[model samples]
Target: MGSCASGTQVPKSTLRSGSRNPPFSTRPDLNLNTPWARSRSSWREEEPVTKPSRKLVGKCFCGAVRYEVADEFVYAANCHCSNCRRTTGSAFKPFAGIEREKFRLTTGDDRLLIFGEESGHDAHCGHCGSLLYSVVREGAYVHVAMGTLVDDPSIRPTAHIFVGSKAKWFTVTDDLPQYKGHVT
Candidate 1:
């Protein structure tokens, strides 16, 4: 676990209240600090814009990492890449791509373990190790783990990506288009 702090999550009331900003402040860009807990210059920050009337909520398996996301999605796909399979323990990982600003960590920001903390990385629960989402497109978008979402989103996987590297034993029965590589 990459967690250096306790897994306890701050309440919504105590956290920064607004539509554009998430309650948590570990992100380096936001620069908002919880005087009692976190400070500036911590982990990465996801850019969230204005709030919407409806939002989707998701959490890790152990209920340690909780988040809220805007219902809008840029794209959604099922990835058959080896890394996606290993992380989700499935033949493919069904994910929804949305802007970073649309997502917020409602609780358990300190409990997140980021893998490949660079241009793109996978955010997992430090405690239960739940694969939550992957920051991609130079950290501009998040391929959110659909399995973690508690509220249904408006989008669904319209295609399969990385089929060339997909598991040999698993068969794709769906009629959705299968791409040998990433969708263009």
Candidate 2:
């Protein structure tokens, strides 16, 4: 029995079938003893392996809207702007920025409602009024509400934006960088 690259043990039955070529078998015409073949095998063994990207799931409070992100976030931030606070009903909103192409509405897409201008809009679950994300930069990116995330993104807020409009009653105690206005 031999193991595959994924460490799965292959049954001996499969290997002895004689219908398929055995693992590590090169072209019959190519001399396995040649330097070229040895170099090819060594190169194959040294090839870098990569893990598949993780998929993150998120949903509204009422579960009326569910979505998935194919990969990790491009960036994360805490927005202290009044608009975010008003929409989220919180002092600050932590969001993860992801490319639009990576975000997919897995379920309840029809239940989503968009508010605000065409250039930027806040998406929420129409059934529960749960804020999901804010589409900005002409829809190139989505600012996903971290609170709505059902899975850990493995990324945390690194900065605070729009601090000038932050609530006076709240104080940011973290050492993260803060920008008076939006970070350009």
Candidate 3:
């Protein structure tokens, strides 16, 4: 009809009678005949996304005990005395003091196991015990055990030293700053 509109003959009842207008150029078809783009062909999907690697690593609880904390976390506490609730049975005792020269020992410091015979010395993991902390007898300091950090020591407690031997059924309504014993 007019030499079939000069080329790509738009005649099949005008391409099914203009199924609601289309036919604008050689490429302007993002609407790609809809239906979610005809079962997806190039809706852009190289599919990769995977970022989460701050390079933190921890062990113990069997693994013979390994450790690494290149940096981050200068404080993070919970304490609550009574010898930190009979040596961490819990009711407080988060700790994570850092800086005893950045703490290392990439694997079993000779099967690391200490446990205070006199004053304060914890440090566990003799093959799956896992405590890893306590050394403060003015030994410059070292008290990890913030649940054996490996990241999550984002930090929050700047104070709360002993709270008069705390644990009278655990209570601390949070306003921080509450030392009743040693804040030094």
Alpha-carbon lDDT of model 1: 0.85
Candidate 2 least-lDDT 10 residues: 21-30
Per-candidate Cα lDDT values, in order, are 0.85, 0.87, 0.67
Better of 1 and 3 by lDDT: 1
lDDT assessment of candidate 3: 0.67
lDDT of 2 by residue, 1-184 (tens): 7555555566665565554543544223436878987999899999999888899999999898999986579899999999999999999999999888889999998998989776689998999999999999997899999999999889999999999999999999999999998877
Most lDDT-accurate candidate: 2
- The local lDDT score (0 to 100) that residue 103 gets in candidate 3 is 66
The C-alpha TM-scores of every prediction are 0.71, 0.77, 0.33
Q: Assess the local accuracy of residue 137 in candidate 2 as a C-alpha lDDT between 0 and 100.
A: 91
Ranking by TM-score: 2, 1, 3
Better of 1 and 3 by TM-score: 1
| Residue 31 in model 2: lDDT | 61
Pull out the clashing pairs in model 3.
none
Worst 10 residues of 3 by lDDT: 1-10
- After TM-score superposition, what is the CA distance of residue 8 in candidate 2 from its true location, in Å? 34
Model 2 pairs in collision: none
How much is the lDDT of residue 48 in candidate 1? 50
